[model samples]
Target chain A: MHEEPLVRWDWIGRNWPNIQVLLEDHVVMSLVPIVVGLLVALPLGLACVRWRWLYQPTVGVMNVVYSLPSLAVFIVLIPVTGLATRTTVMIPLTFYAMAVLIPAVVDGLTAVPDHVRQSAVAMGFTPLRRLLRVELPIAVPVVLAGLRVAAVSSISLVSVGALVGRGGLGYLFIDGWQRQFYTPIIVGIVLVVLLAAVADMLLVLAQRLLTPWSRARGSA
Target chain B: MVAGEGVGVNWLIDFFGDPANWSGPDGIPVRLLEHLQFSALSLLLAVLIALPLGLWIGHTGKGALFAVLSANAARALPTLGLLVLIVLLMGVGTDIPVLIPLVALAVPPILVNTYEGIRGVDPELRDAAYGMGLRGGQVLGRVLVPVALPLILLGLRIAAIQVVSTATVAAYVGLGGLGRFIIDGLATKDFPRTIGGAVLVALLALAVQLGFTFIQRLVVSPGVSERQAVR
Candidate 1:
């Protein structure tokens, strides 16, 4: 048997169109979850914070959800969402994002010191105004930290969706493996890693922009 | 959709209720064992490598930045991609391909948690240990490890759950485990088997989580756990 090269540039050149579509699918599938997860988790996190007892149970459930493998979850959802559909992938990804983000949201909100909260109130700030202008902004750094983790993990996990037929760059892994080729697998791994790094850098930049006062505090 | 949903649930039940799945080389018992074997081996390897490294870095306070960066980087590496890439590179007829990615997946949580746990220990306690004539190794083993026990255990727990869950991917590469049912079923269009396998993996993951909670309770010192709880 002839030894195959680690990467065949010609193969990549021929397959660039398919690869680009998969890449776009991957980005959309991964990013939607983060945006939707934040939308859902904010209120849920607020509820947990408002009712302190709810926090533990919510975290407990989220941890259980988090512990379940993404592949397994994707398969299990096939009944309702059907296979190879974006919804099948996005639904679970959203839950996974929430699992990480909800805790982050709570922790970020709690990180607001008592005096800060009182001062906001002292300055005639309403509860809603205080939360919007004071608390959420203060929570940005911690929330962004969690968002970075969630974002990176989400990007990495999006590939696993390939098993059920929706894995973005993950499809390349399957393609390369079945054909006993290396180009797609190598490309897949590099692109996924690059996506994670880019997502993480963007979140860090967002944190820097949003929380300029906490510039002294170093990276996690 | 409703009718199809009913049939799906029935198939899932029938898949579990059938005694044939309980026996033979392809049985649930065997696959479960394989899953555990892969997970346990990967975790053990990860701990062996990570624990010492984490301990050294934590005790010395050297290379903290490296530890943090590597853990973050490890987290970002797609497990499926890593598994496929390794299998492609190594030409899988051995378990090494599967184990590498699983170990890589398990290492970050353990390494980061252990390092942070040790680093987070009170300096006054370290002073007390040294003032009592304890050497560096003695201080680390007696005072630091015990004090950091809760976080270390937490790290192990996280790693264990992750390994167990991700170990399902072993089946994708022709290795046997609970995931064999999933990957094989999906390939053969066996929805019941796929769902059943998924259920088993989720249960195992939960069991691992609960098992670690029990271990954490048993191993962590009451004083330390209490302090953590208060914090």
Candidate 2:
């Protein structure tokens, strides 16, 4: 049998502004890792692809790093980075983003057909120029797909940082659990899922906008 | 470098070196066992549910959409959030609240990988096995399972380490695990204990990773593994 209604709309309407702030915090924490991860991973992933020997080791290290729990990473940094600091969450989050993104970047670049790469080289495109003008653009969709996973997981893990004090929508879950109230927990789950969906959609949109040729080739 | 402020390697060594910390109800060994118990049970339950479901779906090719959707949905669900939410509903004091979420967290990889691995089997091989008058179950157990073994093991590795790491969240529910050190240390402001716990948990995860990698090598089909080696 079902229990009382968990969705408290009137309560949500009353606390709209506070909810808005939490949502903003969630988005900020989530997006920062994606941007930082891409900046760091792009070059590292390129180097791995270029060097060939570096790929396995890089991925192996990333897997190990990826396996570390987010909460532990946050708590472990408290003495060094201090609790409630964005750096504590951001640094570990960035590492996680890199762990997922680097492999995605490598896969995307490698997925580019070898003949296509050779033709780009034969066209007088310098190595850097080819990567920028040809390979990277082709790799965009794959990289963005990986970005979605990194982004969504970061958004979820950032909630764990709430245990230290401040993190976005996660505080609601903590508060609700402590008080045994369902509203905040329900609201947090709903809003967090909505945020992930919206973020995923935005990335999809960005991929489409950036790669118009993909659509054209698809139709042809 | 300060006596009480910095949690150095010496601090970890000293924390671990203490004999008192290894033998009681609250000792490191006890907590480590508790953590392993929680993680192992969660992994076992997850495998029980996901493996068969994944195999069935992969074998049938029906409900493939459900597998994708569930994997994505599971990924998006925050583990901590789910744990707390379930606790609130179940009225905690039992491990069920904690185990439920951990199981939820563990399932997606196992299910997705098993499904994908089985589906990726060469259609011709599948057809040949069926043509040989083998029953559906026989084809799946003999042909699909062997071919899909590497990916399934990979999935298990990912799931096992993940469950081990995330099981630390069990401490939040007032359950005993290695996370007690981190949580209790933070509450009492014991920097050494906190850092020591975090290090231990990391090491445990790394050990699990190593153990799984070794198992994967031993269990993977040598023919399939040869191809991976060449690649």
Find the candidate with the highest DockQ and give its number. 1
Question: Please, what are the lDDT tens digits per residue for candidate 2 over residues A1-220?
Answer: 8676777788889988998998888888888988999999999999999999999989989988988888888877776777787778888999999999999899999999999999998989998899899999999989999999998888888788887776788889888877787888888888888888888889999999989998988954
Residue-wise C-alpha lDDT for candidate 2, range B39-58, written one tens digit per residue: 99999999999999999999
| CA lDDT, every model vs. true structure | 0.90, 0.86
TM-score for each of the candidates: 0.97, 0.94
Q: Kindly report, for each predicted structure in the order presented, the TM-score of its chain A compared with the true chain A.
A: 0.96, 0.94
Q: Backbone clashes per model, in order?
A: 2, 0
Find the 10 residues in a row with the least total lDDT in model 2 chain B. B1-10
Best-fitting candidate, measured by lDDT? 1
Clashing pairs in 2: none
Span of ten consecutive residues with least summed lDDT in model 1 chain B: B222-231
Residue B127 Cα positional deviation in candidate 2, in Å, after optimal superposition = 2.7
Native A-B contacts reproduced, model 2: 0.57
Docking class of 2: medium
